[model samples]
Target: MRRTITKFGSLAAVSMFALALAQPAQAVQAAGATGTTAASSSAFFEFTDGTDTFVFKLTDSAKIQQARNILSGVETENVGVMGKVVKTPAWYNSPWKYQIAPNSVSFFGMAMEVCDASISYVDTHLNEVGGALLPGSTWCPWQSKLTREVTAP
Candidate 1:
């Protein structure tokens, strides 16, 4: 799928991808040599758009750190770009099962915030997602705020 890389997104993606590519062969082998699947390193962030609350599971360590900063007041921005919305149970236990696509996280500070729509709009219009509701499979609640870091089971 085509990704929307606005401003900082491109730089972040490039650097992360480059870092993945630069990993030493030995390191890769050592990871696989264990014969065990990597333990789930996923982190969940619970956010609210005033009325509704939702959670996003982030597997990228960098993105997790960004969320931490936002929650700690270190980051002044309150808006963030969410990943594609899926029709499956959320990574955490909640009435809202829909979640942002994994690894598609982008922090605040963008001219065009695709996920600036409301949570109700996105939930009720799941059928229209990717076409009209949230173009490019991105969702950014304009007033989204990180309430807390959810402990993943």
Candidate 2:
């Protein structure tokens, strides 16, 4: 079930208030997590305009970081462009948060914020991620995480 927090509480309710605030924060990380499975093992991002598609295959953390820098305007050069992944979406990934690079992603050669619908779709497909991201490592932003999906026991 969903939860919420309330305000205007008396001193006697300090502990309860704290707990309420903490609950939502703790749950946010898992908000859209439907679970994960090892569908793909590489890191990549895909963009499509329905008729045509583009793929940017990322080899290592540096390239991924470069892309992030480009989005944040930290890097003046577009050195983040790695090898072309493919003309059509063709990877399979699990449904989970793969820690996408920070900043608005690309679409049809335009720079704009990625829609939640795209994030959700790509996250689940990873393999055929229609648009958005492929499987991303946790080690991003300066480190890495295994891009493999988590399976239920």
Sequence-dependent TM-score of model 1: 0.69
Q: Please provide, for model 2 over 1-153, each residue's C-alpha lDDT reduced to its tens digit, 9 standing for 90 to 100.
A: 122233434544998889999987666546537453222223455433333233334434554555555555566533222121222333332223332332222222222232222333434555543334422211111111112122221
The parts of candidate 1 lying over 4 Å away from their true place are 1-40, 78-81, 91-93, 111-114
Q: Cα deviation of 150 in candidate 1 (Å)?
A: 0.9
lDDT of 1 by residue, 1-153 (tens): 245547568889999988888776557577778863233367888878889888778887777878888888888864454566776666473666566777677776553665577777777777787886678767777677789998874
Candidate 2 has what TM-score?
Answer: 0.25
The number of the candidate with the highest TM-score is 1
| Model 1 Cα shift for residue 75 (angstroms) | 2.2
Off by over 4 Å in 2: 1-42, 47-53, 79-89, 92-153
